[model samples]
Target: MKILTNLFSVIASILLSASIAAAALDPVSINLRSDEKNPASPVMGDHLQFWSTITNTGTSPIEGLVAWISLVEIDPGNEQPVDLEDWSAHKAVTGASLKPGETLRTDWPMRLIKGGDYRVVVSVTDRGGRQVYTGPTIQFHVRQKPVLQAGRVLPVAAGIPLLFIGLIIFNNTRRRHGNGRL
Candidate 1:
């Protein structure tokens, strides 16, 4: 009987702790900025640069700060809210701790080769490793570099012929008018 009672107590304690953990965690902010205004679409490079900011909104400043920001490939164009934890390679955060209600921004230097779609996830833990807060992920895009492309030129490649043809046609029509034709 005592054993049963003790087991029930332990279970109850676990449940209570879980509830507290759940309560501790709330929504926070994760911001991402890119170097290139038009980052490579199908990004082609050894590494792409990124700047990220991780903020905490909980009542107390979080400690033992460890986070991950992943870049997952997204559909090329349309805007989407990406899940930061989805399909990420697992990159750790830089700072060690964050004070309650304070926003600590991390530089978040990353190396990305492909450029389709990507996002950033900011998660934090307390000193005892209790998950205190987790923020939603933000998505972005990367484009392929133009210089390495075999024949990826601007409008000039398709424009020159059209311009010449138009000019020739105009001049020919003018000549007919200048000659004795109506």
Candidate 2:
């Protein structure tokens, strides 16, 4: 009976220690947003920046964490993940460390490439593959602003030459009728 009691006590202490360690290594929480106060409606060709806040809620410090941004198009029949190579110069932030209750803000500057519905998310993960933290999705629509629309340009292109011809004809007629001099 004494041996059994000792064995149970040892097991209980081990379990308690394991739980504490697990709690200390709890995953961090993150929030992602744009610095722009306006709703994230950016026109195509606009440059924008996003801010990500990563907070360590555990009792221990976290190290070797990596953060990156992902963009996915949600437009009808055009859904696909966007590559960050052309959109952003700086893609990922690595080797970030945070202490308990500490918050770190990361900046991601990107240029809007195509006009479509896109969802942006920021994710953080450790090198040990222990935990993957993802922030809320930010949905924004990229408006298409055509700088030179074919429909709008055709009229202007055709009208300019017609105006020049009309002016020449009027001057010729006036000269012919007014003794060819003024």
Q: Write the per-residue lDDT of candidate 2 for residues 24-101, one digit (tens) a residue.
A: 565687889877654356898888888999998878778888999999999999899999899999789899888888
Best by lDDT: 2
Candidate RMSDs in Å, in order, are 12.9, 11.3
Give one digit per residue, the lDDT tens place, for model 1 in 1-182: 99999999999999999987865566345566655743445365544455566676556666667766654455756546444332333467644766656776665545545446666555555556554455556565666565644366546777898899999999999998899765
Clashes per candidate, residues 3 or more apart or on different chains: 13, 0
As a TM-score, model 2 comes out at: 0.66
